[model samples]
Structure formats: structure tokens, C-alpha cells
Target: MFAILIKIKAMRVLRITFFLFINAFYANAQYDFEKYPSIEYKDYDWETVKSDDGVTHKVIVPDFYINSESLILKINYYTEEAKDSEIYISGIKYKEDIPYTPIGLSSLRIADVNGDGLKDIKIISYYMGNGLASLNVKVIYFFQQANGGFIKIAYEDKMGDNRLERDFDGDGNFEIITMKIQGHKNHNYWLFNIYNFVNGKIENVNSKENYPIMVQILNRETFKITSKLSRQEMKQYQVNNLENYNN
Candidate 1:
């Protein structure tokens, strides 16, 4: 009878262990898009335009901002078949006459993001309000060729004061990092976020909250958080510790 009781106890423990393992596995599963807010893309009227670079571009003016200088353009390319062609969405920038700093077209960068050897375009744009006191809104767009047109594979938007991009995990792909001020007045707090382009979307892989007097770093591989006092002001804080964070 005692032997039977021991066997029954062992079976119960096994069942409980199996159930817990299953629960844990599901809990730590990949991110669910349904749980987050759906992304909304702005509508624009696209027009073909010829630029000084001697390349024809498909351009659009998003109504989000009233500034006429805000324009989005795509670069066209001919495919290997010689008959088919495609266009890649380039960036948002100002016209040549605009006095403001030219960002989109003038500052376009080409890089191989997916290790596919094909160059992709990286466009970063910002909405600067009035003067120094106004908060700036930034948007990053990454585009690649698809279906005879360009598709944005990764994008990130933030109302932060600064941004950074680098390969944080020793991977060929770059990570988008942003630092935002969360509090008001002189008692501001810093919120740092690290985003990775994964499975066609830019996902928040890690985040840190730092006091105004210190800097926080995350290990790109393990995501272990660490902090140190730097006495850097909130707006002045940048990703200066890449060596400590990147794997």
C-alpha cells in the first residue's frame, strides 16, 4: 500500500511540472501584434518628379504637416530582367528653396540592412516646431524593393529630443535607439528605448528608465540592465556607451 502511495505521489508531481513548463513557454512566447496599437499610415498623393541627381522619383506630400516643403520621394531602379523595374521609397525632405536644413533627399543614406548585399535607403525626417522650446517629432523610414515598388520594412517614430542608430548586437543590421524626456520642467526623467527590426516591423526589444544624474546601459545579448552616475542633463544624454551595451 505504501509503495502504491509513493507511485501516485510521483505521478502527481510529474503532471504539475509538465503543466508549469507549458505555461511558462507560452508566457515567454514571441510578441503578439494584436495586443499592441495598430499602425496607421498617412495618405499622400504621389507624383513623379525629376531631381538634380538625374534620377526620376515618385514623390508625395503628406498632409500631416502644413509645410509645403515636406515631401516624400522614391528612387526608381531597373530590374535584372531588363523589362521590369521597381521604385524604392526614399525619404521626406525639403525643397531646394526652403531655408530650413534639408534632411530627406539631401541626407539619404544607403546600407545593406538584411545582409542581402542589396543597398537599401534610410530616411530620417523631423518636424521642428517654432524655436528651441518646442518639442521635435522624428520619423525614420527604411525601404526595400518589392512588387515593382518599395515597401517600408521598418519604421520608428518618437517625440524625443535625440536618436541614434548602430549595430547593437554585433549583427549586421542596425538598431534604432531613442532618448526621450518624460517629465516636466526641471524635474525631467530620461526614457531610453532600443528597437530592433524583426519580422517586418520595428519592435521594442528593451527599455530603461534613468534618473537625471546617471546613465543606464543594457547588454544587447542578455539585456541585463546596469547604471552609472554621469550627471548628464536629460536632453544631453546620448548613446555614448555602445561598447558596454552591444554584444
Candidate 2:
């Protein structure tokens, strides 16, 4: 009789614990959001700016591109002083803006690079030192789809000055346009590369200097490396109205 009574008590305790757990989860979820009361797409003014360590931040909303599949909004912003920065997104009628947790970024620009009608975000950050210094740390982060949430693609640390993304071969995917430096600003050149995503990894197909800065899509299963285009070469391409010569 004692054993049966003990079993009943254990069952009662388990039931109570389960009910408490569900109640707590629901309560927390309900209280997660603030009571803003209304939602609109208005630009937030510069929240803070100071000069002790020289911190500046500004946000501007550029254009809203509405396609048949998705609504792409471009956000342009910069931060001069702060350890952490945030970017917020919201719908035209929703009161809550979704804050994307940033990783290794301070300021950024969003645009549609390949004319695909999809927005890609680019971020640039400078490294902090002991005292004061002036240097630019540029990183190109591509936004891609994963499950239901969007993600930034480039994971390599500290990219260069300028970057362009396009389908270098005739394939339907995009690769990175990396500008490499030989020796600082004076002796550097640009190289356009072709990348292939295979086995869940980004790998380079073929990369060489002197390739045109233009967006060259893959065609007929291969892409050729053309002569390198200098900064002057880019000017000539533009002057002669040459297609696929330079960006």
C-alpha cells in the first residue's frame, strides 16, 4: 500500500512540473516584445556622436524594391565610434522591427549588385588599437537564404578595398571580385576570380590578374582568363562603350 501511494505521488509531481514548464515558456514568449503600440518605416536619427574617442553613427534608408517574390529594402549606415552596432528591418505595416545580430561589423551598405533584384549587404570596419590610428578594414558579406532566416556568406577575415559579386562563368551562381595589393596603395592591382560552391564549400575555379572588372557570366561550361585591366584600362572601356570590359 505504501509503495502504491508513493507511485501516485511521483505521478502527481511529474504532472505539476510539466504544467509549470509549459506555463513558463508561454509567459516568456508573450513578454519578449515591448509595447511600442505602433509600427512604421521611419529612419532613426543619429542616436549618439561624440569626440573623446571620436564616435559617429548615421543611418539612412535608400530604396525599397518590391518584386513578385520578396520585398528588398536597402539600408545605408556608418559608425565611427562604438564596439557594437545594429541594423533593424521592418515591414511597411508592422510595428516591430527585426534586429539582425551583427558579426564582425560596424558600418555597412546594402545594394543589388548583379541586377538580380535581390539586395546584398556590404560592411566595412576598422580595427581598434592602443591609441589613435587611421586605417580602413573592409569586409564583403553576401546575404544568402538559409531555412527561413537570411545569412551573410563571406567568412574570411578582413577583405580588401573593393569587392564585386557576379557570375564569372555562365553559371547561375555568383563569385567574388577581389582586389589584391602587391605593396600598399601604389603597387597594387585587381584580380577577378571565379568561385564554385561544391560539397558545401566555396572554392576557387580559376583566378588570375588582368581579367576585366566586368560581370562575366559562365557560358558553355567554362570561362577564360583575359588580360588584366588596369585603372586606366577601365577608363578606356567606358570611353569606347565596350561591354564586359570594366566595372
Candidate 3:
């Protein structure tokens, strides 16, 4: 009896290596809001206009513009908050209004965001002074392509403050609730994504009718990805890396 057939083929190779390590731990398990909502609409609550009678921005592109004597607190990104708004830019890089500030204290908007009919460019900023988590915010988008091209989506947050719920769900479209990071900070986690502008670029229409706006942006994310998914500095937040995003 060849040693009982080598202990029954080593117990059938440990049950096929524990069933392939439980299917690779549920396929890299992490990013769960009922399995990370893909996309869904019908949750719009915007319209609080007080658009500072002077510089209600809409950055028209006559080769990159943001006039109104080069704006500076002409609020209108949903009635600016978390440090009002300030903008100034003229034909970027070649300089004009002179300022591309970020890292906190900002607000700039231009619609058609991912709808693909063109028109896009958003810049939002708040503050935590980036001491590595504890209420950080910085959402940036610059999607616009019809050949003139410009697709630069961005997201950041170590704790909270990340949203751009324009027409959040009321179906008119536009949904982006941030706070998504990935790997290598002790394996990060916490993600909720639903990027738009499909047929030209920017995808990941994560769907299932967006499980209640991904449970209301991860229960109004302020340190709730199941409490930082066992925080080791929340290195477990993940959204689909349309090539591992950020910056």
C-alpha cells in the first residue's frame, strides 16, 4: 500500500490549497458597500444659489479662462463652503491670473461633468492641513474630450470631506462621492466610485442601481469604511484604479 497512497495524495493537496485560499479571499476582498456600487441615479438635492452677485464662475475656454477681472471668491460651487472660494487663471501655464492653488481652500466648477456632451473641470479643496488624515478633502476633475482632450480625475481623503453630488441621483446624472485609495500603506481600503463619460473615456459604471448612493457616500464618510477598515492609517481604501489613480 504505497504508504496509503502517500497519505491520500497529501489529503488531496490540502483540499486544493484550501479552495484556492477561499477564492483569493473573495477576490481581494475589501471595497464593500454591498460590493461597491457601480452606478445609479436619482438623488439630486442641489440648488442653493446665492451666487455672489459679482463673479459666478463658469470658466469659459478661450484657451483656458476664468475671468471677472480674474475671479477671487466669486462663489457658486453649490454656495461655497469650508473656506469659501477663490479662482484666477488665464490660459494656464502661459500664466495670466496666476494661481493654481490646491491642498485646501478652493472651489471652482464647470458643468457637463462626465455627461460627455463636453464641458468639464472641477477643483474642490478644504483643509486638514494634510497632517495625514483627520478630515482631509481634495477632489479634482478635468474631463473633457472630443479630441481637444482633457481627462484628469482625482480623489483624496484620509478621513472625510469628499463629495460632488451634483444631481446626485435624481437621474439628471452626475455622481461622485469620493474617499478611495489603494494598496501599500499597509494595504489601504475604503472606496466608492461611479465615474461617468463612458463612450469616450472615464469608465467604471459600477452598477446595481448604486445601492443607495453607496449607502449615502459610505454613511457620510468621516472615518467610516467600517471604521477605517481596521485603520493602520486606512491603507485599505480602494476604488477601481483606472490605473491606480490619485495625484
Candidate 4:
């Protein structure tokens, strides 16, 4: 009789252990998109434009600022087939392709780079890898010319990294402000750097330290919080981060 009682106690303990394991696994499961509603913006129309090289490009023209000088277009093209991805900017073509692949690129800022009043283009690219799997997220930047051409600016391989075109130092020309991740641990911090374009060149300013990995430009001269580190908030965080850049 005592042996049977001992066996029953063991079985009860095993059942409790199994239940705890199941709950933990479910709690830590990868992010699900269905929980959030606002993030799923109905797909917008994509405009097809052909380049002189006989390549078909899918593009979308986002809304513009009132003082924008030139129209900015976000374009994507597959080199030979639809599998290998490539992105380009209308009006401004780079002398060469810039490294770093963005998941999506849109929302452009048009301003005069040299105070000529003719608009130049500044573009933001949201870089993220495949979802629900081992994903990667980063940002790529592009610039434009008064004659309506685009040039690559910078590329980063971590989430929340972005480019800002503003005269943060009261200078006449637009400066580039970017945030970068510097380490690889779970507690990795971010670094904010500033750059100025002189004679059509990009130079990095003083950059050191780590930030919260998420920031947003509220206006011409300020930034806002978009997200932080938490398992439940990742999807919302990514969606919010993407929307911030597009804006």
C-alpha cells in the first residue's frame, strides 16, 4: 500500500512539472502579428515604372511636405528574376550600389542641399529580414540631387538605426544624424553619430556610446520614443519603428 502511494505522489509531481513546461513554452513563443490591428495597413497601390535599361520597377510615391522641391519615389526591382531583390530611387541614381538590403523603403524628405531652393531628396530604408524565423533588421539611407537623382548615404545592420537630414548644428547644409548598435550581446547599446556633407561627400562626426535602440524624429529638431525591449512589444515595436521612418 505504501509503494502505491509513493507511485501516485510521483505521478502527481510529474504532471505539475509538465504543465509548468507547457506554460513557459507558450509564453515565450515567437511574436504573433494578429494581436495588433493598427500595424496592418491595407496594402497600398504600387506604381510600375520602367527604367532606360528595360527593367520594370515597382514604386510608390508617398505624400510630400509642403515645401518639397522634387518628387521622391520608392522603387524596387529584381535584377534577372523576382527572387533576388534590388531597390533604387528615381531621379537620383548612385554611381554604384550601396551595401545593405532594406525590407522596405519609403517616405522621402525633399530639401535644398546647397541652399539653392531647388529640392534635394533624403530617403529612409527599413531593413529587416524574414519574419517569425531568425530575422534581421537594419536601415539604409539615400540622398538626392536638385536635378532629380538619388545617391546612397549609409547602411546599418541593426534595428532602430536610422538617418536624419537636418542642420542640427545651425549650419546651412543638411547634416546626417544616425544611430548604430556597437556590440553583439543581449545588452548591446546604441551609438549616435552626426555627419556633414561637404562638396558631395559624407563624413562621420563624433560617435560613441549606446542608446535605447529606438528613437523617432518628432520634427525638424527633436526625437521621440517608439519602443523598448520586451517580448510582448516586439511586433508593435517593429511596426512603430517602420512607420516612424516612413513619416
Give me the candidate number with maximum TM-score.
4
Q: List the residue pairs that clash in candidate 2.
A: 39-95, 169-217, 169-218, 170-217, 170-218, 170-219, 210-227, 210-228
State the lDDT of candidate 4 residue by residue for 1-247, as single tens digits.
Answer: 9999999999999999999998777565421111221111122344555565434334444443334432435444445332344554545434323223333544444455534343454444344346412223333444444454444544443333223344544455554445443332343333334455555556543221122233333233223333444323322212112212321
Note the residue pairs that clash in candidate 4: 91-148, 91-149, 92-149, 92-150, 93-150, 127-138, 190-210, 190-211
Candidate 3 structure, TM-score to reference: 0.30
Cα lDDT for residue 43, model 2? 28
Quick one: RMSD of model 4?
12.9
Which ten residues in a row are the worst by lDDT in model 2? 31-40
Compute each candidate's TM-score over C-alphas.
Answer: 0.39, 0.34, 0.30, 0.42
Global lDDT for candidate 2?
Answer: 0.37
What's the lDDT for residue 52 in model 2? 58
lDDT of each: 0.41, 0.37, 0.43, 0.41
Candidate 3 lDDT by residue in tens digits, 57-146: 333333232222331222233222423343323332211121123233343556665554555666654544544443555555656566
Q: For candidate 2, lDDT tens digit of each residue in 114-207?
A: 3344555555544432321222243434443332233433322224332334454534445544432222234333233334443334455443
Q: Model 4, 206: alpha-carbon shift in Å?
A: 2.7
Off by over 4 Å in 2: 1-108, 113-117, 127-136, 140-148, 154-163, 170-172, 179-201, 207-247
Query: How close to the true structure is residue 216 of candidate 3, measured as C-alpha lDDT?
Result: 19
4-77: candidate 1 lDDT, tens digit per residue: 99999999999999989987775554221122222222333334444553334355543312232333555442
Quick one: RMSD of model 3? 15.2
